[model samples]
Target: MSVSPFRIALIVDGEYISAWQYLMLERLLASPHAVLVVVIFRQSVATTLSQRLNAVLLKVLHALDGRFFSCKPTAQTPTSFLPLLGDVGCYAHGSKRYQTFVSTQRVDVAIELTGQAVLPEMVASTTHGVWRHFYGNPVHWWDDYTNIREYARRQDEIVSGVVRYMAGQAAADCVFYATTSTDKVSINRGVERTLWKMADFIPQRLHELATVGEALFQRNMRERVLARPLSSQDAVAPGLITTCRIALRYPSNFLRKLYKFLFRQEQWILLTTSHGNVTELGLLENFHKWIPPRDRFWADPFVVEQAGEQYIFFEELIYARGIGHLACVRLQPDGSHTEPVKILEKPYHLSYPFVFKHQGQYYLIPETAGNHTVEVYRCEEFPHRWVFEKNLMESVEAYDATLQEYDGRWWMFVSMRSHQSCSPNEALYLFHADDPLSTQWQAHPQNPVVASAAQARPAGRMFTDAEQLYRPSQNCAGVYGRGLNLNRITQLDQECYREEVVSSYLPDGDFDMNGMHTLGIGRGLSVSDAVYIHRRLGRLDHWIGKLSGFIDQLVWKHCYVLMVLPLTFLWLDM
Candidate 1:
């Protein structure tokens, strides 16, 4: 006989919902047999009506799409009351006044995201019980170092008391944990109990949950990767911020610095191709006074020098979004250029113009991150026409890939934020580019050359100056968001590389109070050095984005201040 779908009770303490959790929720609910019961903890009466309605709307949307869920708001209880003696919170007990609510419902499994302090006795005694402690991993637990002291204090209080640990033992028959290493060796020690590798758990009380949330996690990954549309075009958010600023902020900002070092001193010429208000390539360069007739966004400038002849190939964005085709322009020695000539046009979007020559053969590499696969192209005839030769680095998750030839070996590096735990999965993945045309790409045994999501990611090619290699990367540690910390890769080899804080652009000169992300980088004719193009997606990006801050402020104020009205509505609805 086929098994009935597992009934899942997703327990959330308050307003924290990770992208990974959201994706897995959708996947688990994808099975028609499974039922999702979302238990939302309402801590305060001040939450806004709109916020409450939206929360219900979210559950309703999921239910309408085939999920079976209900939102239950209990009283705001303190973590101290829980019987569990662990760092996590407790909420297993029904609200003091809501005993009937627990008696009326049957939860097959109670999966707690990260409210370890709230797992009460009433909540634990449910049938076939299980709880997923998402914060058990070291990588994620230290995402905010500042919260460590506060969390540690709470942990001591819980362990000293017997209720917390005992409640944990009594609540669930099984415990599911996600962690890379134990606390003794790895940085994330003592945050929670890990049953993954360690056998220190009380076997008599809890069985290990081996459900391998892999399938569930993969579904979530696919949704995020496919959600972004392939084509995109926007002005290189203005400013001449140094590479150091971006590298220090976004972890991928170093690519900008490496480029500047390689070509910063040369005098290059400027050639304006199409004049359109929608296009931003030239306006940021002080061409805003005169408006052109054509409304098209051009690709990053492509420069090639051979036998005293320089050729430039750029993309034209026809509708201000879709990348049209490769256009070629001839450049004079003084940096002056001829009219741009359209060369090749493909149905797919393309940008990040990269051109290199080897053994008399010219090749091009574009930011094919949107294609979800890596591909290389060969110049069939110069300027406009080319043909796709091979696809490299298949079945990998990454964006913004750049290739480099170093020490007689070819290396292809890309930025990837892997699936599952999201503590800066943005790391540099290297592959051996055996042949220009062959797709036989081999990953370096140490796959992730750089692990710091705040650093190691590339904004462009690992540019070189005087035989010394340097990379432009983003630095994201310290603050939530602000400016870049341009880093210089002093040394790189098979084992690892060292980066130096060349310069940074943190607001108020505080390195620990800002963040930055690099978008693109390349060598241009106008300047001798490699120009790294970047954007500072600071806290302003979040607080100013689509009224998100306003919505959050309204929600918090209303939910906490005017709770009686919504409570009445809920009581009536029930």
Candidate 2:
């Protein structure tokens, strides 16, 4: 049976509609279950000359480079603009014109995308309760307590300013919804990336809000109203001068990058140990490093002890292909490891070769997200060959597919990102089945069990100690793979899931590395990977490597532009 479409009414600020709001509008129109019935654009009664000039400049820039310069609304808005009095609250109870418009359109749900308090109580009094998009500071108040760098202070202020300018057109409703970030990168490009990344999340979130509004309207209309009212304290207003100072930091950021490139080298993985006790490995001085060959870097190490022999499996990333292949090396009794041999390779990239024993048979589940499927491979020959088995999940963009048996059930944890998302490190999803190899899988009731990147993406294998299970997660707060957080699973089942962070591991010492991300242990042998800047500027190989990398980055960045240039020129000539 098909359900009827829900009518969604949008209350937008006409004089200023942000790119995020415009994207949300487009997403709503594209949704099948929701139809945009009315667009009540609240226009200001008066505007200063400067404001009008800025608006005109924005319109001209959008016409030329709309995709990159998508900061304001365009002439391409789909819905007809219904201009309403901006100061509807000053009127008697509610503006008669606005109330009449709502009543005539029969709006089932009203959404305020322009974080303004221009929404009158009369609108909610007539239609379903109003739901507001509460855009707040990029960095939360709690982030100050973290061990982030000093540069993040100014960057956060700048981001907060941009969010306020774009979203603070009107007063938001009580139930505030916003995205939180703990990233500590201070460069201007980092700030720009964060802002653009958050914009991609608005559409999906708005659709979810509309779905919730529909369910609440059907259940209890009055209960749908937010209990806590929005106040001035809920919003952040960064000063104009401070915002300008932050924007000025962008030119200097290029200098910082150049300095790093000339002084530092590329990041390579370092192998380390923790004796028999993985938790006791606290400081960097305690472990010895295992350096690989010059042409390849090894990372994402997973150790497995079978019978009396121990094997360390990891990703051997070739510099030329820029793709990783599964490699393995035997750990000798003397604490030394043999040279790694490539055991598995595919047309697409692979990493995180999580090996385990199930029913006395060895199996591997490598990170095959590049193939758009999560697959399992059965060991055809010990420590060498693997034959393809059935795919656990297909047609899903997932990464770091970690599997473990817990409480008599096989649970697989993976990170999934939306099609629009650039990083897959923000949403952790779970699937469980009676058998590890079963085709039938059930998604957890609370999908994306963990949403924040700080503790969502799996770093390596999950382990158990003292009757408690702990999962290793990537601490992407400062940057990707900046550190690792060990989270203890307090509660996990089909209905609910919860965890508490037990410990954090950061890279420090003479290695001059930013972070340590992966950790795996088995049978007195603990293996982990650390990232460090590897420089060889004075050497001939360094120049060759540098030239190759430059070409690679250039081609990757402009591949689409190169494809379209010829067609564009041909069309122009015609």
* TM-score to native of every candidate shown: 0.43, 0.70
Residues 1-44 of candidate 1 have per-residue lDDT tens digits of 13455555555654455433444444445544456653535353
RMSD of each: 17.8, 11.4
Which lDDT tens digits does candidate 2 get at residues 237-322?
A: 32232223333333334554675677665555756565644456435566677877667778888988767898999998988898
What value does the lDDT take at residue 365 in candidate 1?
A: 76
At residue 369, give the lDDT of candidate 2: 91
* Predicted model with the maximum lDDT: 2
Q: State which candidate has the highest TM-score.
A: 2
Worst 10 residues of 1 by lDDT: 155-164
Model 1's alpha-carbon lDDT is 0.41
